[model samples]
Target: MNISHLLRQYEQGHRDFPELNLAGVDLSKVMLISVNLTKSNLMGINFSRGFLTKSNLSQASLNWGDLTYAKMSESQLIETDLTKANLTGAFMVKSVLRSAKLSGANLSYSNLRGANLSDANCCGANLQEINLREANLTGVNFNWANLSKARLSCAVLKQASFFGSNLTDAFIKEADLSHTNLEQVNFQNSRLSYSNLQGANLQGANLQGAKLRYIDLREANLQGANLRDADLEGADLTNAIVDNADFTNATLRDTKVIGTQLKPQTIQKNLSELQLKRNPNYAGSFELLSTSYAVAVFNKDNSLSC
Candidate 1:
């Protein structure tokens, strides 16, 4: 059916449109609330500014469609194929997108607060500045995705794969990222305070200048991770592997780390190397008082004092 015919039918109180093949259609700014478009083929459709709230789009193919600024809140998009679709600035709050294919999609500035995207393939998606606060992202594959400046506070991200992702400056406070694979992720300057990262794989990840205060890092791998200038105050790192991990100038005040294998010189050299590289006026007379709650004395000449 044509767009005009569909609108006429909708005006007559008819809302069912299942299995409809509306490929390449221009349905921009159309109000399709509570419409059933399940199993429909909507590929290449221009749905920009469309109001599709409470719509049933399960198993639908919206691949390569333009959903910019679309109000898709409370919608059922389970198993939907939105691959490479432009969903920028879409309001998808409380929506269900379980196992949805969103690879290479541009969801920048989209508000997915309280939404469920569990087990979804969001690899390589551009989620910059997206607000996903309190959303359920469990087992979601965010590999190589750009989540810069995204807000994921209180989100359930258990077993999520964020390898090679860019989460710089993202606010992920109080989130559960247990057993997640976060290798080589760029989390520079990010705030993950009070988060549960127990048993999470953060090897080779960059946590430089990040705030991880009061976080749970029990049994997590930190090998080769960059914690330079990062704050880990009051964090529980019990039995966490810190071998060769750089903790230069990082705060470990009241941080728990039972049976850590990192040598005192190796940990201290992290600071020495950074100071030497950044500044060449080192006095070479530094002393680390303790490793548990790391204690270091500094001099007025910009040198570590005993």
Candidate 2:
């Protein structure tokens, strides 16, 4: 209750300021538009370059808070703690931060466009180059988060965990990440075009040079996932597990690979060279099994059976 008596009780207008403690307060560059400061303690507070547009700061503790370069547009920060908070280069557009804890938070280069951060914990958060374009991040945990080069295009991230998260060069196009855990997540050079990742786990995920065009990966696990040089053209990977997944020079045009473990002589020699360079009247049915292994079947009206 210092800061020149909270800026003379907000210049005698007196915007709420519920449960104010204002521990270690500095309130750097304060503007505090539409301020409420709900349940505020604001431990180690600085609020660097603060503007705080439409501010509420719900259930705020803000442990070790700095909020570097803060603007906080449309802020609410529900259930906020912001543990170890710095929020470097923060803007936080359309912020809500539902169930926020923000464990070990740094939020490097943050913008957080359309932010909701549903069920957020953001474990071990750094979030380098963060933008989070269409952010909701449902059930977010982000276990060991770094999120290098993060943009998170069209983000929702349902059931998100990101167990050992880095997400190098991440863009995450059309993101959903259904049933997400992403056990050993790295996602090197990630783009993830048209992403859904149904039943996603991605056990040892790396996804080297990933673009993953038309991605879905139904029943997804990808036990030892790498997907080197990955493009995954028209990707589906139905019933996906891919026990020792590597897909070295992955492109897989019109890729599905139903019930995948991927070794019926490497899916009948890569679907017989993608049916002789993209369906030269390729009627699909194959069974050349003298134990040399050739049993290709990819029929979901995209027919290619063997």
Candidate 3:
């Protein structure tokens, strides 16, 4: 209670400093705008370059807190623990941080535009180059998070997990990330344009040269997925599994292999040149195919897989 009697009782305006302990306080570059400091322990507190705009700091512990270059726009920080917090280059526009814990947090290059951070845990978080445009981030866990070059355009990220996550070259345009786990996720050279990723697991995911235009990926799994040189123009891939999927030199113009349980001679022995746009005994008929060096081999009692 001794930052000069909490800045002389917050300069005689006394904005409700609930349970304020302020352990290890430095309070560098302090402004403390609209401050509440609710349930504050503020362990190892530095709050580097601090302004803390519209600050509440709800349920705060702020373990190992530094908050480097902090502005924290519209901050509430609901359910805040912020374990190992550094928050480098924090601006945190439109911040709510609902259910925030942010395990092992670094948050490099942070902007966090329109931030809500729903159900946030952010396990092993570094969040390299973080911007998080239009962020709601529903059900966020983000396991092993680094999120290299992260922007996350129009981000909602429904049911997000991102196990062992790096998200190399991540932009993730028009993002919803439906039912997201992103199993074995890498997303090398990532763009993810028009992203939905319906029922997303992305089993064994790498997605080399990943742009993934017009992406929906209904019933998505892509078992053993690599998708080398991936383009997937007008992509839908309805009822998708694609067992042993590799699709080398992948471009897939007008791509939507409806209810895909692939076996047109395993796309002609690993796609030496298969261009049947329709009628390969067309099962209730579907194909907008134009492939190059493709490999799809799903036939485990296929009628759109189990």
Candidate 4:
């Protein structure tokens, strides 16, 4: 059925329609509250600025749909296929999207506060600057997603895949990120105080200037990662792999480092002297180790060596 027919039925207050097939239709600025869209094939449909609050779309196929600036609050979309959907600037607060397929979707600047997104497939999605505060994101697949400057405070991200994701300056304080894959993710200047990051894969990640006070990094892989100027006061880094990682000018006062495997000389001594004062006990051993690994880490073009 076309959008005209749907609008006509909506204006008449008819809510008994069990199935609405508006696939590939332009439904911009239409109001569709409390509508039943179960099992509908709505691929490539345009729903920009449309209102779908409290709608039931269980198992519906909305792949590649344009949902920009749409109001979808409190919608029930269990097991729905929303792959590659454009949800930019959409309002989805408190929406239920459990088991939904949202791979490669563009959710930039979307508001999803308190949304239920457990077990959702969001791989390669563009979620830049999205507001996901207190959202349920357990077992979500967000591999290669862009979450730069996003606010995700108190969000549950257990077992989430964030490989190759850019989370620069994101606010994730007190978030549960256990077993999350954050490899190569940029977290520069991000606030992660009291966050749970146990067993997270942070290998090669850039965490420069991040506030990590009381953050948990147990068994996390941080090899070759950059932690320059970061604050790790009272944070846990037990059993973490920090080999070849840079901690230049970082604050580690009373930070837990039990079983932390890192080359102490990886942090440059001459480039900045305050960096060496943070860990005063490593000055003698760092000098010996730096002479051994300096040629390997830095090439022959290196001029920063002591």
lDDT by candidate, in order shown: 0.87, 0.79, 0.80, 0.81
Q: Can you write out model 3's per-residue Cα lDDT over 1-306, one digit (the tens) per residue?
A: 789888898889887887789878898998878889888899889989889898899888997899987998988989898888998889989889988899889988989888998998999899998999889989889988899889998899899888989898889888999878898889888899889998799999998888998799988998888887787776788888878877665665556667666544333245444443344553323443433222232232222211
Task: Say what the RMSD of model 1 is.
Answer: 6.1
Tell me the deviation in Å of residue 237 in model 3.
1.3
Between prediction 2 and prediction 4, which has the larger lDDT?
Answer: 4
**Number of the top candidate by TM-score?**
1
- Model 2, 1-306: lDDT tens per residue? 788888899989988888899877788988878889888888888989889888898988987899898899878989989888898989988889998899888988889888898988999989988899898989989888898889998889898788887988889898888778887789987898998988898988898888988889888998887777787777877777777777665656667655454654233234444432222232232322233333444554534544
Superpose all Cα atoms of candidate 3 onto the true structure and report the RMSD in Å to 1 decimal: 11.9
Residue-by-residue lDDT tens digits, candidate 1, 1-306: 888999999999999999999999999999999999999999999999999999999999999999999999999999999999999999999999999999999999999999999999999999999999999999999999999999999999998999889999999999999988998899999999999999999999999999999999989999999998898777777778877889776766656665455444444464543332122232222222234333333443334433
Tens digit of lDDT per residue, candidate 4, span 153-176?
A: 999998777777788889999999
Give TM-scores for every candidate, taking all chains together and pairing residue i with residue i: 0.88, 0.39, 0.38, 0.83
**Where does candidate 4 stray beyond 4 Å?**
261-263, 267-306
For lDDT, the strongest prediction is 1
Q: Clashing residue pairs, candidate 1? A: none
Look at candidate 3 and give me any clashing residue pairs: none
If the candidates were sorted by their lDDT against the true structure, best first, what order would they fall in? 1, 4, 3, 2
TM-score-superior candidate, 2 or 4: 4
Candidate 3 segments whose C-alpha is farther than 4 A from its true place: 1-4, 14-21, 24-33, 36-42, 45-53, 56-61, 65-73, 76-195, 198-215, 218-235, 238-255, 258-261, 264-285, 288-306
Task: For model 4, state the Cα shift of residue 51 in Å.
Answer: 0.8
Worst 10 residues of 3 by lDDT: 297-306
